[model samples]
Target: MSARAALATALDRIERYDEDIGALLEVDAAGAAARAAELDRSESHGALHGMPFVVKANMCIEGRIASCGSRMLEGYRAPYTASAVQRLIDEGAVPIGIANMDEFAFGSSGENSSFGSTRNPWDLSRAPGGSSSGSAAAVAARMVPFALGSDTGGSVRQPAALCGVTGYKPTYGVVSRHGLIAFGSSLDAVGVLATSAADVERVLAVISGADERDATSALRAPFEPAPARTDLRGLRVGLPREYFPADLDGRVRQPLEQALDDLRRLGAELVELDLPTTRHAIAAYYVVATAEASSNLARYDGVRYGARIAGDGSLQGMFAATRGAAFGAEALRRILLGTYVLSSGYYDAWYLRALKVRRAILRDFQAAFERVDVLAAPTSPTPAFRLGEKLSDPLAMYLCDVLTVPTSLAGLPAISVPCGCAAEDGVELPVGLQLIGPAFEDARVLSVARCYQAATEHHRRLPPLVAGGVA
Candidate 1:
């Protein structure tokens, strides 16, 4: 289909179905049409020729409102596009809109988004896990064929799992971070959310090179696609004993075990691995992420960009008012926690210790990778929960990331693909199995994901809104 036609279809779906899903924070139907028209006649179409996609609200797209789903930047417009977004546009992909996310990408559940939560299209009352909530939901709803998301922790992978889509987070520094509004700089990575592994691989191919603009960008590496077949004759898949806790629901465990069985049948050698430091990953992740957030977010002081408070008699007053009014309760909570962790005397005790723990976690992954080609675990302990189910308890929200955080800390590549569904309350919630690869081994991660996806039709199931309609 032509780019214009694809965009029209996306816009029609947005108009017809977005109201109930809340997947989009902004939809530029006209803008997208114009871009598609421009690409339609280009002599040399790039990899994403005339493709339409959504970007997480946090990533800047020139002239568009780049609200990070927070009151602070509710009406903020981007002065320039993020390098990742720009790369997509250059490749002939048109940005259809910006999707909702957890405020400042701080929450694990979509409910934390100040614009309102993005509903899991599978079950409206359930969350489309966040802070890549809208990115995952939009793809699941078929509002767009693919979308861009950022992962500081499990922001992209967790949501992709819950929404039954493919979410791939590249190794840190593999993708340019020049325009991604910071959450945890060291851990953050630009990710892609799409319907299949091939789509992800295509998008990543175009945007995965070094950029002088981003000092952290990795040196360019040749794009080599993983072998298409899943004859993992010599591939060793590691299963960490810690990932399956006693408290794990049977609905989640059964499908996960079945997925492992399928891998075994496909000739993957299953090896039991121990990541003892996994117990401290959640606490360590929070401490490290918030500390980095404290530093990265300090720039939004009303003096430069974003929402500014009016009628300030002094500079301090302006800064205080702007942040006070712009930031939401959750963002404020993170800022406070971040500031406290990085504060003068406490930095050594809290922030420094977290760094030590982070190193330990990385070491654990390094050790395990020596014995296995890839590590497998349940992406999330349970499937999507009701919208407000865990919002009241911050720790509970943090716990949802247990299986995904260790990989983030290790700066390894990971992909989450739906394995099956969990039967609970007479309903089946999606279950995602996560595959973690060594640093710069994104191809392997994608390869394993595609293998599993081909072996099962789990990822092929569409959410109700896309398969049928809102009942």
Candidate 2:
């Protein structure tokens, strides 16, 4: 099929099925079709020519409303395109719409999105691990072939794992963050979600280099094709003891063990590695993420870009009313927590101490990388949970990042590829095998994921919902 045809089909799927899945907050059919027509007429198209994709609402996409899943910016529109989105468009990709996410990318269950929760296509009632919830769900549902997401603390990888798709968070600075609405500025990185590793690579290649607009972007390096090695003969794979918690679900554990056996058979050398600070990753991640968020979000004071509430007479009234009316309960909670932690007399006690712990975690990962080429673990301790599962308890929601947050905090590359399905209540739930690599080693990490993917058909399976069948 031509790129236009494929996009048309995807659009049809979105219109027909997204109401039930709640994966997309917006769908720009006319915009996508216009781009598709342009691509069809252009003779000189690049790698992503005519490809259909989605951007998380947090990323600016020109005319699209970059709400970031918060009511605060419910009717807001971007004045300019996100650099990453623009780069993809230049390469011939058509952005179909903006995917749903947790409000300001705060929660893990994806239940916190102000728009509504994006269901795991594998199990409609189950939560799609978030805050990249809709990015993963849309790709899994084939509403779009690939999508863009932002990860601060396991957002991309966790959701991808839950949805049974490939999601990769590149090393910090490898991809430009110019258009991405900041959550945890230093920790947030734009990432890709797709059905296969090859698709992820295709999108990454087009947007990986540095941009003058984003000082943190990595400088362009000479093109080097990833080594094609299916065999993991000399590759050192580490199994971090801290990742396997005592309360891990037995159902998920079985498939994880089977994956280890499969990896061993593929010739990878299994090594027991100790990342002692892994236990502190979740705590450190929340502290650092919220602290940075508190600062970055100060810009949305209604005087600048987003929604504004009418005040009685004073400037103080305007600010208070705007924030009070614009933000959701969850968004307000994070902002308040973040502000308090960074306030005088509390900075050293909370934010500063969290930074110290974060440094120790990074050091631990660096020390482990000296011994192992990649770290392996189950992306989540369990598969998707029922909707409204952990929404009531903040700490419960935070714990969902246990297996995925450490790699994120250290600014390393990681990929989540479906390994197998665990049976729960007579329904099969997808299991994801996560691979962590040293910073700037995205190719190596993806290469390992591809090897695993080639040996297993887990990632190839799609949720039945795309065809309007029961999940």
Backbone clash count, each prediction separately:
1, 1
Residues 1-471, candidate 1, lDDT per residue (tens digit)? 789988888898888778999999999888988889988887888888888999999999999979899887878999999998998999999999999999989887888888889999888889999999999999988888899999999999999999989899998888999889989999999999998888899899888889888898898773456879856678899999999777787878998999999999888999998999999999888889888887888888888777888647788888888888888877787889999999999999999998999899999999999999999999988899988889888889998899888889889999998888876676668888899998999898888878877887888888756687421
Model 2 reaches what TM-score against the true structure?
0.97
Q: Which numbered prediction scores highest in lDDT against the true structure?
A: 1
Off by over 4 Å in 1: 310-312, 469-471
Clashing residue pairs, candidate 2?
72-326
RMSD of each: 1.7, 1.7
Clashing pairs in 1: 72-326
Q: Tens-digit lDDT track for model 2 on 92-112?
A: 889999999999998887888
TM-score of each: 0.97, 0.97
Residue-pair clash count for candidate 1: 1
Local distance difference test, each candidate: 0.88, 0.87
Q: At residue 371, give the lDDT of candidate 2.
A: 97
